[model samples]
Target chain A: MSLEERFNEIVREYSERVYWHVRRFVNCHEDADDLVQEVFLKIWRALPSFREESGLYTWVYRIATNEALNYLRREKLRSALHFGSVDEEMLRRIDNDPYFNGDAAERALSKAVVRLPEKQRQVFILRYYDEMPYEEMAKVLDTSVGALKASYHIAQEKVRAFLSKVD
Target chain B: MVRKNDISTPQGYFDELKGRLGDIPHRDRRGVRIFAPWMAIAASMLLAVLIGNFILRKTAAPVEEDNGWDYISYLAQSLDPDGLPDEEFLTDVEQ
Candidate 1:
């Protein structure tokens, strides 16, 4: 297939998946939408030199995940500078999120997920929300499966405890 | 089972999204285009001005003003040493 066709196919295949991935981190529909576009824009730009060293799906996830992580860090720094707690700020965004259609329990679960440390958040979200296998996640995260499992286990415990109390 | 996602987009967002992404030209991936001819012209003009300034400095004599060192030397040469006040006499008058 021509390059444009290939790029379009990628967008068609991964956009929703990438969108939800970003949405989990950002907690705001608008921010997630913007970030999803940014992730694809980055992939499109870097498409030429994509050496195919990893699977295309893994590569796309890596780009989307990195965008989400970077966006989170920027938001955290901004929130901290503005005299707000990052967790509170993110939860506020989630509270105001128009696209979220979850029940109270799901909302509580999402809050619990957001409260995890950044790397653990990634591990938890990918494993629990996307149902991504650790082997595939390792390719996207550039982490060993063992480390991912440990992080997810810790994250899972934290979420479970938070849910038990809240839900 | 992983819970169903809470987030939802407007219907057919993915369809419109692909089209929007396609509109973005691949040139964006490449660095911005620098105007090479304009840069070359600017470099040449700068070089020309520098060379012209250097040549002017080398070829043109510096303009002398009143009370300049050359003028003072000329004035001292024109004077008779005998007609000038002695250093000892001048020092004594100052005291």
Candidate 2:
């Protein structure tokens, strides 16, 4: 099949999955929507260079994960510059987000996850929310499985601790 | 239960996003990158030929078929003989 057909197939198959994965990182619809498009744009641009070294799903995940992390880092810097606070600003964005309709517990979970450092937050979301296997997570995060498990453990503890305090 | 994917988007957001994205103009960057340098080289060669023609026309052969001093004579006629270009300039002006 032609590249356009392949791209269309890939978009049909994975766009929703990519969107939800991105949403977990941002906890907002508009940002996740924007990022979903960005991820596909990267995929389309990089498709020719794709050597099939990794599974297509994992390859897409790697691109999406990097984009999300880079976006979060930028947002943190922007928030700090704008509001004198990253944590508070993210919390406010999460809480006031029009797309977020989570109840108290889900809101608490989001807040707790947001409090974790970048890697820990990522590992936690992939492990706890997405239930992605450690091997797959390793592929996406470019870390050893042992390291990802360890990071997930640390993230779980921190998130649980935060949830306990907030609850 | 803290259900993941609790976030909501505008209705039909997923259904429409693909068409919307595909609608945005995209080019095959790989194809572009592969062919861009050759296009530049061909374009530059064509440009050089054009400019070379222009410069050659601007500084064409100065000698006539018969007299062999068409341009120098023209300049000689155009200006005072005392103010005519120096001999070396005239020599260089020969085709």
Candidate 3:
């Protein structure tokens, strides 16, 4: 296929998925929108070098996940520079987001998820939200499956504890 | 249970996003065209001309005022270091 045709196919297939992945990290629609575009731009630039050794879905998820992590890191640094908490900032974003129409419990769950340590949060989101298998999560995260399982376990406990307190 | 996503975008958002992303390759190619070989060559020639003009200006001999005294002095110095010419030379000039 022509490069443009191939890229369009990728966009159609992965845009929404990437957007939601980013949205979970950022807890804001506008930020997710910008990050999603950046993810696709990187994909477009790197497509010529893609060997497809890993399946396209795994490669794409890897890119999306890395971009989301980078964005969160930057956001954390920015909030630290301003003497604010990144988790608090994310919670506020979740509360104020116009696109988030979750019920109160769902909103609380989001808040709980965001409050987890960064690695745990990533594991939690991939396992719980995406329902991604541990093997695939390992490929996407570059972590061993055992490590991913451990992180997800810790993340799940944290989310459960937070939800119980709020309830 | 918390749904994985309760957030939704406006209708047609993904379609629009696809269109936007699909244009990236063409947009990037258009940017690449600006640096095509012809443009690069033209830019190089322009830069060479500019550098050449600058060097010429910097190293050029300054234009001197053409007042006639210097020419007269030059002629006098070449013919005779003393202001007066020899009588024989003067006679030759007259002849």
Candidate 4:
């Protein structure tokens, strides 16, 4: 297949995956949608130089993670500069959002996941929700497999403890 | 007896999420396509200008003196020997 065909296939396959991955990081659907497009646009621009050293999924995941993290950091800085107040009611509304698929326990788990450090949150989401293998995760994160495994383990333990406390 | 809770979400939860996150707007895509090439060209030109400026600056830089002795000699010879650089010479050699 030609490169454009391959690229289109990738977009069709992973656009939703990328959307959900980003949505988990930022709770807002609108923001997630924006970042998803940005991520794919970046992927399209970067595809010319993409050597197939890593799997395509890993490359896409890497782009999604970077876009999400950078978006969070930028929002954090903007909030800090603007002295924005946390919308606790809005957050509660998000918890009760009709589109959220989780049960009560799962919702609580997601809330706790949001509270985690950025790296831990990324590790947890990729491992649990994405069900990605450690090898692929390591390629996406550019970390050693051992480190990714350790990170996932620690994140799992943290989530368990947080959920247990919530219960 | 264990109780089974078959809690099914509303029929369209996932579908709602999908709809809310539809494709990027067509106008935005048009803007991207139109401006993307120009952006690339502008970036390349800017890079070229920066590189040319750097090369010019490097080539136009003043040459350094090889040693302090050559500079010192130039300074000493330019000044009058009688007015400076040797009271002893003036006393002995008759200024």
Highest-lDDT candidate: 3
For each candidate, report its DockQ versus the true two-chain complex: 0.35, 0.24, 0.31, 0.03
Which CAPRI tier for candidate 4?
A: incorrect
lDDT of 4 by residue, B1-95 (tens): 11112112345544554443333333345666998899899999999999999999888968875989977876777585654556535554485
Binned by DockQ into CAPRI classes (incorrect, acceptable, medium, high), candidate 2 is: acceptable
> Order the candidates by lDDT, highest first — what do you get?
3, 1, 2, 4
Q: Considering only N, C-alpha and C atoms within 3 Å, which residue pairs clash in candidate 1?
A: none
Clashes of each: 0, 0, 0, 0
Q: Give candidate 4's error at residue A33 in angstroms.
A: 1.5
TM-scores of chain A across the candidates, in order, are 0.95, 0.94, 0.96, 0.88
Q: What TM-score fits each model?
A: 0.74, 0.72, 0.77, 0.63
Candidates in order have lDDT scores of 0.83, 0.81, 0.85, 0.72
TM-score of chain B of each: 0.37, 0.34, 0.37, 0.36
Q: How accurate is candidate 4 locally (lDDT)?
A: 0.72
lDDT of 1 by residue, B15-78 (tens): 8777776655554533344466677999999999999999999999977656688767756755
- lDDT tens string, model 3, B25-78? 888778688779888999999999999999998899988879999889878776
Q: How would the candidate models be sorted by DockQ, starting from the highest?
A: 1, 3, 2, 4
- For A31-79, candidate 3 gives per-residue lDDT tens digits of 8888998899899998988887888888898899899999989988999
Candidate 2, residue A37: the lDDT equals 82
Q: List, residue by residue over A6-123, the lDDT tens digit for candidate 4.
A: 6666776787788777877776666776887788778766877888877788899999999999987877677677886333433564576656755788677767777777888888
